[model samples]
Target: MDFGEFVMARTPALLRFAYLLTGDSHLAEDLIQEALVRVHRRWSSIEYQGGPEPYVRKAILNQYLSWRRRRSSAELVLAELPERRDPALGAEQIVERDEMWSLLATLPRAQRAVVVLRYYEDLADQDIALLLDCSPATVRVHAFKALKRLRAALTPTAVAGASHGRA
Candidate 1:
């Protein structure tokens, strides 16, 4: 497929991947745009090689993983925003979903990326390791740590304490 066709077919999925990595819709859009710009230059070579999707994905991942250090000390808090309620989801489900996103936001960048790749993207550990340029054991460790943190935060006592303003 040509570059335009490739982008037309893949942009939505790419945006979703970026959104999972970023947890911010605008930031995800920026990442995809930047990644597309970078990939456009090498479109022919990438198409000649295995495929463009992997290259574009890598560019997006690199853009996301590196954006943290490139920016200032200010951080984007994605947890709280004025968004319209989804009519299809019940209040409890919305709360759970918001809580999940907030919890994801708390994780360190690498750990969060690993979690998104392994679970949300449904990638195997080795594939994630390759994408992150780390060993499979390291991927497993990050996944383990992310899960551990999520579990600790979700425990009944922990939730109760948090609700009671007890850190």
Candidate 2:
């Protein structure tokens, strides 16, 4: 596919991937825009490398990591009001998802990226490592550490209760 067609097909998934990485819609949009600009400049080289999606994804990941490093000292602000919920879903589910996002946000950028790429993107260790320019072992370590932090933040009892409630 051509560059425009590739972008049209992949933008939604890319945006979702960015959102999962940054946990902020605005940041995700900015990240994608920055990445796409870089990708556009090197579209021919990227296309020659094979499919552009992987290249674009790697660009997005790099952009996010760089942005995080630059903004390390900045404070993150959340909206005062919660987002509107779907009436069909239970309040418990919304709370659980929000709590999960909050916990994810507390993780270091590398750990958070690994977790999101592995779990949300269903990427394997080698793929994640390639994306982050790290060893597979490093990816595993990040995932383990991130999961440990998440577990400590949200107890098993709470997870079980949430699951049970859903059932």
Candidate 3:
């Protein structure tokens, strides 16, 4: 496939990643469009430099963070977004993902980026550090803290559900 085809094929995944990052579908679409436009404008410049997805990813994150810094409402208005239900997923996984995403939204910008990059994007610590312009150790620490918070938030719910199931 050619460059445009490759980009078209990957745009949905990129938009989904942005959606997960921002939790706003509209903003996610806009961000993806903007990121792709920038990438397209510099495609030749990026094509020779290896995979450009990382560059696009970094640009999206940086743009989001910058917008957050300048805007009054950095948080996405996701109150109306209903959780996606999957029949294949057991109740626990469904609840866990939702709860985890909720807690993730509550985290500070940098911590949220770390968690999203590490888990959602499955990027290595070094990759996340590079994207965030931080050290690998700092990425590890931020990921550690985010996971700790998620664990704390989810554990009680799990325990209560287990107890209720047994009753």
Candidate 4:
């Protein structure tokens, strides 16, 4: 397939992953857009890399980091807003998701990125290790710590949600 086709096919997944990483839908969109532009510019080079997705993902992460660095301390709190809510879900479900995201946000950047990439993106630990340019053992450590923090934040009902396959 061509570059446009590849990008079109991957955009939704990239957006979801970006949203999970940055938490704000609009900012995620902006991040993805900028990253995609850069990817498109280097498409010939990236197309031979086996998995351009990781390159794009790393670009998005770097974009977020740059954004954070440029932001004032006062803006940091707001810039890290939770993912946008779905109007379809019930209030309780919405609140639960928000709480979960909030807890995820509390993690150190590397840990949070690993958790989202592993659990939400369903990537193998080795893939995440490659994406983050870390060892598989380090990815495991980050995932472990992130899960611990999430588990600590969960209420009984939220824990039950996981058992019910709702989380």
Candidate 5:
């Protein structure tokens, strides 16, 4: 497919993946723009590899990883706290989603990427390993650690209850 056709077909999915990786819509847009630019420049070569989507995704992931590394290296101080959430926006599902995202944000980058790829992208461990340039065991370990952390954070009451029962 042509570059434009590929972009039209893939942009939405790419944006969603980027957003999941970055947890920010604006950052996701920036990531997609940077990735697409690189992909466009190498479109012929990427297409020769049989598909551009994976190549674009890898570019986006690399860009995100690089951007995050740079961002973390710079220290910034906030003068004040941000505003509170709107009470009118108190849908249970939205709150749950926000909580989940907040929990996911606590994970290390590789673990977060592994979780997003395995669950959100529904990719197999082997595929994620290939994409991340790691072994399948490494991917599994990341996923295992991420899920363990999520479970502990999400269900502290259950864990507490189990501890009480054991006592």
Candidate 6:
């Protein structure tokens, strides 16, 4: 497909991927914009070399991994998330999702990216390692550490104990 068609079809998914990577809507938009601009310039070669989806996705991931993106990184606060709710998800599930997002925000960027790529995108460790420019063992370590933190945060005793310590 042509560039425009490819963009129209993939932008939503791309946006979601970026949002998960950056955890901020505005940053995600900026990532997509920058990635697409570079892709547009190389469209002729990319379209012929391989499918644009994977190429564009790798561009977005690389953009996210770049030093500039990490230079002034900030957490996307829970207050910044929209108030809308999905009808298909129960209230408990929604709360769980919010808690998960908050917990995920606490992770290191590389670990968070590994979690999103492995679970959200369902990519293998080797694929994630290639994307992150690390070894598969490194990717697994990130995933292991991330999941460990998530589990610790999600444990009932931890949550209950945390709340009790608040006041």
lDDT of each residue in 1-167, candidate 5, tens digit only? 99888777777788789889988876666777777777888787654455777778888877876664322232212232223357777599778989999999999889999999999999999889878889999999999999999998999998888889995
Cα lDDT tens digits for candidate 1, 1-167: 88888877777788789888888887786777777877889887764346777778888998888875333344323323324457999899989988999999999989999999989999999989988999999999999999989998878798677679954
- Model 2 clash tally, residue pairs: 0
Quick one: ranking by lDDT, best first?
2, 1, 6, 5, 4, 3
lDDT of 1: 0.82
Q: lDDT for each of the candidates?
A: 0.82, 0.83, 0.73, 0.74, 0.80, 0.81
Model 1: CA > 4 A from native? 47-50, 68-86, 156-167
In model 2, the Cα lDDT at residue 140 comes to 97
Q: Give the best candidate by TM-score.
A: 1
Using alpha carbons, what is the TM-score of model 3?
Answer: 0.71
TM-score of each: 0.81, 0.80, 0.71, 0.72, 0.77, 0.77
lDDT of 3 by residue, 1-167 (tens): 44577565666667778877887777786666666666677776664345666777787888777664232233322313433456899989988777766887888778888888887889999888888899999999998888877776768888677678895
Checking candidate 3 for backbone clashes, the offending pairs are: none
Instruction: Give the CA lDDT, 0 to 100, for residue 29 in model 6.
Output: 70
RMSD of each: 6.8, 8.3, 7.9, 8.4, 7.3, 7.0
Q: Which is superior by lDDT, 1 or 3?
A: 1
Q: Which candidate has the top score in lDDT?
A: 2
Residues 66-143, candidate 4, lDDT per residue (tens digit)?
554332222111323344557899999978888888888789888888888888889899988887778999999998
Give lDDT tens digits, candidate 2, residues 1-167.
Answer: 77777777778788888899998877776787778877888787654455778889999999998884333333323322223458888889989999999999999999999999999999999999999999999999999999988996779787777778894
Off by over 4 Å in 3: 1-3, 68-92, 155-167
Q: Report, for all candidates in order, the number of backbone clashes.
A: 0, 0, 0, 0, 0, 0
Give the lDDT of residue 59 in candidate 4: 79
